[model samples]
Structures are given as structure tokens and as C-alpha cells.
Target: MTSDQPAATRLSELLGWRKSPDPGLTWAQVEDRLATEVPRGVKDLSLCFPTGSFGGWIHFYNPVQSERALDMFLGRAKTKTENFKYARSLNHAEFPHRFHPEEGGLVAWGHGDQHTYFWSSQPGPESVLYCDDHGDGWGQYPGSVPEFLHALFMDELETEVLYGQWAGCRFFTEFPDYAG
Candidate 1:
């Protein structure tokens, strides 16, 4: 429950996150595939917990999960395909800004029942942000990916902004197959 401890240890103790056995993919591999650089925080995250779901509600997109979702999300920009209609519907410029994947915009790392977590491409004070899917801004989550998860699991963050619909529930983590 302390920031001084390791992020994985804290997550394991607080939220029951377990690493995947697949050795996971590296940042370089993902970047090479995407043809773009990703934040080191996100890289560390994918290494730590690939294809993890939180509270049986939120699913974080890792290399394996992104294998399909990422392509679909990107494909929408080209063919307006229904394969990822959600991507087509997202408008970052709306009241609550989200990931747009163009012009150096934010990118999604995870999504829950009512919220989606994103990492901003634009350099700023904090690296993480989330929107409630509605037109309201829920502000930002501080620290890098691991740091943010540490704080979040330890209940060190504001509940209103961090969990939304998943608030008050005990967190969970697992590595299920990427069905998407």
C-alpha cells in the first residue's frame, strides 16, 4: 500500500495481479508492429500484466489482446469498418477528451463498462487519463502506468475519478485469451 514498494508487489497484495507465463511482448516488438513509439510506462505495463482484466469488468489491451482490437481500431480509420464501430464513434474533441490515434493524440490502454483508460501522446504532467464515456471529464490519473496502478490498487487515488462504476469493488487481475 506504499508507493515506496514495487508496483507488482503492491498490485499483487492489493489487487491480486499475476504475471502472464508467455513472457509477454516487448515495447520494441509492439512499436515495430505499430510503426510508432509507445510510452515506456505502457511498455512496462504490458510486460507486467498482459491481457489482464480488473474486477472482471475492465480489460486492458496488451500485445495479445491488441493483436485483433488494435488492428480493428486502426482499421476503422481506413475502411470505416464495422469491425470496430466503437473506434469510429469515438470523438476525442468532444467535451471529455479521449484517444483519437491521429495528430499525436491519446491511445487506449484499457476499457471498462463505462470508462476507457488512455495514455496521452502529448507530453504533460500526468501520463494517464480516463473518460466516463459520457460527455464529462473525469480528469487524470497521476504517475506512469505502473505507478498509477500502484496508487490505484492501494486506494491512494480519488475513487470518483479512478473507478467510476467499478468503485467499492475488490479489484482482480487475470490473463485470459484475447477473444476480441
Candidate 2:
């Protein structure tokens, strides 16, 4: 559960993909490949947004804010007597209607429906910005990623399993048991 153990396990999982013949690739190589191939902005953002298994802590912040949080989290992790490795960033672009490169998906803190969702898409002739899930799905709009980021920093969005529109998207936060 420590950072080193999880890092090694994750690295092994990545390298073990199909069991590559080249033994030269190390964990560092895997990290480099992930950094280069995946979009840095999105990948970094995902790291800031922890999934459900990790108590669903959402720290929304701009680039600067994100770095600050990351540093603090790393520091705290280092101080801990128990070693725990948090989840690594993964590709989450498939749910275009919900997530984006700038502001991460809807993040709200506290119990109940506290999270606010946002999506940029081409609505009719002009592009529009939506507070929650809306629009046909596609295109870009405006709104500082800092807005959502800051809000997330202050609060933790209540994660839930959304059916309907989000059914096909690969990156969804589903509860352990949800009939629907």
C-alpha cells in the first residue's frame, strides 16, 4: 500500500502488458512513455481527481493550485508511517460530454448531490456552456478551468453512478452496487 510498492506494482502491470520481449524497459521507461503519449494536461488533472476507492477526494484547482495540492499530498504521504500508493492517472477522454482537458468533470463536496457538472459543446449555431450535463455532445465553450478547480479545492463532490447518457462512457464513477 505504500507509494513504492504501488509504484512497482503499477509499473509491473504496465510493462507486463502482453509481456514485451524487450527487458530493457524499466518502470522509468513506462513512466516516460505514459508522460509522452498521454496528454500531459489531462493526465495530470486526473491525478488530482481521485477515484471512488480512495474515498473520492476531489481537489479542483488551476495548474498552480493543482501543483500546490500535489506537493502537499506527497508530503503528507511521505510522513505517513503506513505506505499507501494512490491510483495513477489514466485516459478518461471517452466521456467527452462530462470531462475535458481543462476543468475536470463535475466535482462537489459533502453528502447528497453536491457536485456540479459542466460540459462544452456546439449547441445549434453558436457554442454554449452548460452547468450540468446538457446539449447534443460536441464542440467547445468558455469558462475558466480555475472556477471548477477552485470550487473542488474547497469541497469534495459527491460521486455517484449516473445512468442514461453516461452508460457508454468508459470512465464513470459507479457505486459498488447500483441496480440501475
lDDT top scorer: 1
Candidate 1 residue pairs that clash: none
TM-score of candidate 1 to 2 decimals = 0.68
RMSD of each: 4.9, 18.7
CA lDDT of each prediction against the hidden true structure: 0.57, 0.26
Q: Find the candidate with the highest TM-score and give its number.
A: 1
Candidate 2: stretches off by over 4 Å: 1-41, 53-116, 119-129, 132-147, 152-180
Q: Candidate 2: TM-score?
A: 0.21
Model 1 CA RMSD to the hidden true structure, in angstroms: 4.9
Alpha-carbon shift of residue 166 in model 1 (angstroms): 6.3
Clash count, one per candidate: 0, 10
After superposition, the stretches of candidate 1 with alpha carbons farther than 4 Å from their true spots are: 64-93, 96-100, 124-126, 159-168, 178-180
**Range of the 10 consecutive residues with the lowest summed lDDT in candidate 2:** 80-89
Please write out the lDDT profile of model 2 over residues 46-154, one tens digit for every residue: 3333211111322222212233433333333232211111111222242333322223322111121222223232222212222222222222333223232332322
Instruction: Assess candidate 1 and give its lDDT.
Output: 0.57
Q: Candidate 2 — what's its lDDT? A: 0.26
Tens digits of per-residue lDDT, candidate 1, 1-180, equal 676765655655566556443543445656666555677776556555656576676676565345654454344322322212344367434443433445555666666667666677676654677666554555577777666666665466775654543335556665555433
